[model samples]
Target chain A: MPTITVDGRRLEVPEGSTLLQALDELGLLMNGVDVPHYCWHPKLSVDGSCRLCQVEIEGVPKLQIACDTPVADGMVVHTTSERVQRAREGVMELLLVNHPLDCPICDQAGECKLQDYAVDYGLDHARTREPRRPGRKRVELGPTIVFDEERCILCRRCVRFCREVPETGELVVENRGDRSRITTFPGTPLDNPYSMNVADVCPVGALTTRDFRFKVRVWDLDEVPGLCTGCSKGCNVHVGVARGAVQRYTPRRNDQVNETWICDEGRLSYREIGAPDRITRPAVRDAEGRMQPVSIARAIERAAERIRAAVLREGPAVVAALASPHATNEDLTELRRLLDGIGTATSGAAVVEGEPDGLLLQAERAGNARGARDLGFGDPGLVFEKIRGGGVRVLLVMGRDLLAEPFLGGTDPLASLDAVILLDTHRSALEQVADVVIPGRMLAEKGGSMTNHAGLVQRVPAALEPAFDAHAEGAVLARLRAALELVLPARSEGAA
Target chain B: MVSTLVAQAPEATVLSDELRAAIDREIARFPEPRGALLAALRLVQDELGCIAPPTARAVAEIFGLHPAEVLEVLSFYNLFHTEPQGRHEVRVCTNLACSLRGARTLLRELEEHLGIRAGQTTPDGRVTLGHEECLGACGYAPMLRIGDRYHEELDGPAARALVDGLP
Candidate 1:
């Protein structure tokens, strides 16, 4: 470890660590110190363009950018030296001369680096009386981003991202001197799946998300770290909630999986979770075939009695379990245990398959197929084979949308079975065919865990109450396990 | 419909020889011929009032790209304009930071003076008023990008005068 002094404070840091890293490790606020940075995200590659991270190395005459400059043993760095502060303030002042101050209605308010730097460097006063040069025409970059030329500081974060991260070179800075502005090639829209991230990474309000424009202020929303349920990939995300409802989804950095980027589908999918069509209550079929609301206990008892009778009539071999990849690992484990205890053979998990566009949507439509496999459920075809065999007379379908399957087609899969029990949150074709339907709670309404494609288990905390007499899949399975006297192992412990 | 079609035609002639020469210098920098399309379009837009269809088609032809491709690219990026505009274009950033600081009020004032909303050009072609999501100059919320210049710390009156002063 190399020892370094910052702002008169002495501390030892590991060799090869940058000063910013050391400052972060020490938990010292680095805002007041003169550090010129643009395109140097702590997590991303260090291009160090803005020359803002200027710091005084004890022996060196010229200040160095802390981000690109690595630390050496016995190095004494002065981040708050007058020379360094003046250099940083000069760069910031220049950056703002043409830069627009639109914080009031800008989406990046409170979180923008320009605001933070301006406040910290005390460059609030404008010295230049010259009229600022205007930028090019305002361009609608894509469905998600709009470009303003004048306010751009020419940091090139969006340019670097398009060129390197998404490999979609849709943006580039054109012209020189007063003519320079970020512009894309003619006919090329910024249509990359990760384009919205550029808006998030822009230090200033240069890049903005189309979906979030004028919707809600960043200060008005509360952010909750959660996993994206868009697909089996399970990208980590922060769900922004406002007024008791989710406003948007932003990617959370996870080194093992998404790595600070999420697909457009995942970012825009929050609205679907809170959609009005979501089934909120458990319903049972009456004599007239109408789905009537029932108490949670009544629904559980009805499901248990039907399963017991079917097992008694046709033995455990006659009962089949149709699992869904959408259920969490804990819920899957409980359901498997309950089925096994009832002498019903375990069926493989069912998953919706879609075209893989090589972005984020996997071939598997369900978000938790990998988790179900981890919990010992294999192939859905095997379960179907068992059902087709003479022994299986009843089936319990959990979370699978049976209506979408060609085998069920217009007919309900449950209609063919002697007894059908459906546990799902959506009123799909499976619910219609099911002899008994139990309204299941959504992932946002439950405290459980899911395993993403990379086998990372992510914990999801309940954010809202389940609507319409629904219960979480885990709770419903727990109740069924109790009725069946099934013993299952405790939740698997690990970080997701 | 006829007026819109007429508006879609080239509002100005192709880039002048001087602007074309400047663009050609930029084109020579890239190994790939198509790499300079963005620079060329900016040059063309600078020379002409805005990017008209014929002007875009000429630029696309020079770059060996389809006119439709050039139009798509022009429409996709915010810097290029497909339609005619006022002598000055005033774009106010309305992203998160600016929104919190009241960029909306500044934008409304600009629109009121120009007598055109964001994304529209004034009837007299004096100013094209628009709202940008973010211009990366978040520290100065309520900022406007006019012509090739950025004006920050703007009040309603200041923003209105800036647009009104455009040639």
Candidate 2:
């Protein structure tokens, strides 16, 4: 352990801890100690660009970047020295020399790092008398990225990311001196799975997402830390919502899973949450073939009674439980307990499979298959085999969209079962075969915890009210346990 | 207005020797001749003061690219002018950092002085004023680009003088 003093406060940190780590440990005590930085996100690898985190060391002659320099035992760091402040201002000035002034229309206006650091350390008056050398302006690098050459500070963060993180060499700086600008080689477009992250890493408005350009301001957005439901990888994301609608999704740092980048498919999947076809209410088939809305309690009671009747008449061996890998561990645990109480041990888990590229999108389409396993559902293949064996008379399906899965042997396994009960948020082929369908809320509409593939539990909070009379899967399963007279242990509330 | 007339007339069959020389030099610098499309277009824009579709097509033909490709690059990059403009171009950097320091105010001043909004040339065709996002010059809050030069730390008076001084 090394003890370091940051602004006169002594703290012991792990040996080789960066000045940033020590500052992080000090917490609120060092609030006024300003540090300017960009391309040095806490979640991402140290870039040391922007030179904004320049700090004065007790003995060092030159200023050091706090983000890159590790702390030494008995070391003293000063973040608010005049020399360091002047250095940051000078760096910001040089960065702004060639940068275009297009903030009124730039998408990154509110949340851009350049804007924040400039306000903190940049000189009030620019000394440069010569007109800025006109650089490449709006250059459409690819389908998703629009590059503003004048806005680029040559930080190389986007280039480094394309090469290091996603390992896609799409962006490269061309020319030199005043003419240098970030560009693709002639006709090569910046097309990659993790291409959108370049826009996220750009400190200035140089790299802008074509999909999000001019759509919404960053300040107006309210971010909800959640997981991407596009695939089973469950990349951590911060869903930016504004005016009761999801505006955009950005990757949140989860070292155990996505690191600092998420795939474009996951980034754009917020549109699906706002899809027009989402089911909002609990509907049951009434007399004369008319579907009527029922109360949540009534729906639970009717579903429990039907399951109990089937179990009593056909025995527990005939009752089968079908769980979706999209559900959280709490929901799966409660559902499994409720079914197990009735003596039904044969449970099946359904997971949708997609194209696996070994990055971003895995073959598994469900985001919470690992959570399902943690709740004792076991392998999905076993569930498929049990359903095919013809021992199951009643099937209770939760959250799985069987139609979306082409390799599920064409939904014949579901058709063979008697009295299929579907509990899902969307309309799928499995729901059509289901004798009773219960509309459930989407992940964003409910509060629950999903244990990602890395086994790290991440909590998702409800950003808005349920679209209709929908309820959280955990809440629904809890009510079902009450209806079936199954006593289960309660899970803790709040996000992990 | 006279510059627009000259631009429209297609006066001489011969390209300006200076313009031809600049394009030739840029084309010679590239390993693949077509790689000089952006550079050549910028050179032509500098010589003729605007990039007409025909001139852009001519540049594209020299580079073995489609005229649309050349046009796309011109439209995509903010520098090359697609339309005839005043003798000088005034582009204000409006990226995030500059915006926070009141680049919008500088833009308003230029617009008021030029009597035209961004992306439009003055009625007399003496200057083309435009607003660009970030020019990566965060330290120089409220900066504007005039011709091949950058004027930083600009207020209303400073921005107006820079625009007014444009040839």
Which numbered prediction scores highest in lDDT against the true structure?
2
Model 2's DockQ? 0.02
DockQ agreement of candidate 1 with the native complex: 0.03
Residue-by-residue lDDT tens digits, candidate 1, A179-270 = 66787655556877778988877888878788877788888878777777778888878888877677888888776777677778778988
Q: State the C-alpha lDDT per candidate.
A: 0.73, 0.74
In candidate 1, position A419 carries an lDDT of 67
Question: For model 2, what is the C-alpha lDDT against the true structure?
Answer: 0.74
- Deviating ranges (above 4 Å) for candidate 2: A1-5, A10-33, A39-49, A65-75, A124-129, A286-298, A354-363, A380-386, A401-407, A486-496, B1-167
A1-496 per-residue lDDT for model 2 (tens digits): 8888877877787787688856655553236555767756654567786677888989898899998999899988887778887888888998888666678877779988778877887777778888986866678888999888777887788877766665555566655456666776444467777788999888789888888888888898899888897777888888888877888899987767887788888899888777777766666656554556777777777677677777667766777777878877777888887776667777867677667766667777778877887787765565567767877777778865544544365567777666677788877666556666777766776757887666777888876665467777778878887777642122111111
After the best TM-score superposition of candidate 1, give how far the Cα of residue A264 lies from its true spot, in angstroms. 0.4
TM-score of each predicted structure versus truth: 0.71, 0.68
lDDT assessment of candidate 1: 0.73
Q: For model 2, what TM-score is found for chain B?
A: 0.80
Q: Rate residue B159 of model 1 by lDDT.
A: 76
Model 1 clashes, total count: 63
Model 1, stretches more than 4 Å misplaced?
A1-36, A42-45, A70-74, A135-138, A355-361, A389-391, A401-411, A486-496, B1-167
